[model samples]
Target: MSSVCVNQALTDDELRWVLTRLDSDKDKEVFGLVCKRWLHLQSTDRKKLAARAGPHMLRRLASRFTQIVELDLSQSISRSFYPGVTDSDLVVIAEGFKCLRVLNLHNCKGITDTGLASIGRCLSLLQFLDVSYCRKLSDKGLSAVAEGCHDLRTLHLAGCRFITDETLKSLAERCRTLEALGLQGCTNITDSGLAELVKGCRKIKTLDINKCSNVGDAGVSVVAEACASSLKTLKLLDCYKVGNESISSLAQFCKNLETLIIGGCRDISDESIILLADSCKDSLKNLRMDWCLNISDSSLSCILNQCKNLEALDVGCCEEVTDIAFQDLGSDNVLGLKVLKVSNCPKITVTGIGKLLEKCISLEYLDVRSLPHVTQVRCSEAGLEFPKSCKVNFSGSLTEPDVLL
Candidate 1:
């Protein structure tokens, strides 16, 4: 199901030319067949070229393959990807990738309501569409998709910032089969929008509202009351208006929750977060309380003691935690943890992080950047070794940006 081949045959300069030459589109077939190693590049490398490298490059990349089931031009793209981008751009992307099952155009700054209308044309086969972080996208764009993409299941418009209750209402009523919906950072959404969503999409499994500041207990209560049983993952990060009461209601109602992220809610107490984590310990796989200033060592310790299934934790900026908090979470218990990021926490030293390295044998990613000990930990003299597959970035707190966590 997976394969990785290193491009060792070409020098760095040669590889650069091959990728640059890929823009011409005509060289793609021969580019794909240049060697057996080049085949893997087709799947993984195409997106990189589309995002960080060049948007026009995707046209050449898209031309190489006969079938493109998914296309993600999400957070990474800095510009447009169409030959003649307009309000009609979404239609263009839709039509070109005719067989597209998934389309992601998050943060495409140039995209607007008109371009979004073009996306309705893609509705037949498009099941997943993420237009989040796109400041220009509005209800007109969403309405087109809702009316046309009858088969859509997941729609993420988080941070579109302009969408109101009308858009949410249309989506809920029209896309009855919708499952995962992320309306995070939509400043204008309120109880009206949320009520419509809850009433319409009873089957929604994941709801992400990381920073929709306007949503209050009224908006959240609808989800707690209606979508509680079916909810699997919920993200309420930085939603300052949502207090502990709302969080508690969510925990009590959404018993089947698997992943919960409530980072940056300053008003919510550490006690509430701890209670939620402890309550969902068995099923909670990923929990991020980053920048939750109220969460101290006591609450985090509670999480460690109760949440044995936790695999990824972000306790960044929790100044109260010390080495004692990690004492209970030795490597023996967290064998499945792949990412351990605790950047910017003051209490932990690189030496404290050694406890994790000593225990979590399957650890592949360790990021302790901005911790005080990044400069202190000796890479050569730790008497420890990283796995051949593991990657760790320890930016220093010192002038060198070195530290460990």
Candidate 2:
């Protein structure tokens, strides 16, 4: 047979099979450059897209990527030159993409309740949505989503200050399948709201209420009790109202808790930490207690001794934690500690950090910044002793300091 006839015999499905086997997006792009038919097939096969979103851009995207399931219109930093996605763009998205499952509108400041209402009415299959930092969103918008998107499993409304108890009530009533929720910086959500939410959403696994000042022990304790078996990751960073009471409740109920972040919770004392370490010894893998003023060597020692599977620990700014805490790292079970951050700890000296470097063979990241006794010269001299794969941060720099001649 002739070469032209053999090439013409290849069907669309065969071309698509070849496209799927391409190693990278670059290779696929090169394949698409062959002809207009290949380009159209690549566009139709695309399932995920991340690009700058505006009314015209979204229109173009909806026409090109007909089967897009995940659309990311998130902007890390908003620019004045590029207009943010607004309600009209969302209307276009809802009308065009009927099967959209994951929609990320992070930092889309122009979005409002009207835009979300459109999404709720159209995108019933939406399972994941992130509206973090969308200051204009309120309960009215999220309530619409809850009423429509019943299958929602993940929702992040971090920095949406207008969200209140009404939104949680709506979610509890409809979105009972919610597994992960991030309400960080939602200042208006108080204990009553959290209590209402956890009463129904008992299957929640990951919850982040970081900087929710109105949330205290009452709210967190309710979550710990209600979602005891399911809750795994909990972040209470900067929740000054939280104290040992919440920690005690978590220790008693949430045995599966894996990651706990209580940074800036000054009220957490050694007693509760020790109890928590003992109770969650087998499950706890990551613990961040930075700026917890009451944590001392006693609790630090208890954590190192108990949490055999601990992979990451951050006790930065715990003034009372001294070099004695690092002594426990020598244990065989504790050698698996991978990431340790003791930055700004005045009592931790070169001796303590050196001990950690020598003991933690699998350590990948070590942050010793702002330690008074860990000077650049000392770090330079001891740099060779650190794990070959580990990255050390000293005085805000990760590079190894040059030793003086």
Instruction: Using TM-score, give the best candidate's number.
Output: 2
Tell me the TM-score of model 1. 0.71
Candidate 2 segments whose C-alpha is farther than 4 A from its true place: 78-83, 328-334, 379-384, 399-405
Per-residue lDDT of model 1, residues 106-158, tens digit only = 66676777777767865477789887777777888889888888888999887
Per-candidate TM-score against the hidden true structure: 0.71, 0.93
Model 2 C-alpha lDDT per residue in residues 1-405, reported as the tens digit of each score = 645742387898998998899989889888877888888989998899888766787888899999999998876773633436789989999888888999999888888999999999999999999999888999999999998999999999999999999999999999999999999999999999999998779999999999999999999999999999999999999999999999999999999999999999999999999999999999998899999999999999889878888888989899999999887654564367888888888998878877776768898888888888887687677763778888888866675322100
Worst 10 residues of 2 by lDDT: 396-405
Instruction: Evaluate model 1: give its lDDT.
Output: 0.71
Q: Report every candidate's CA lDDT.
A: 0.71, 0.89
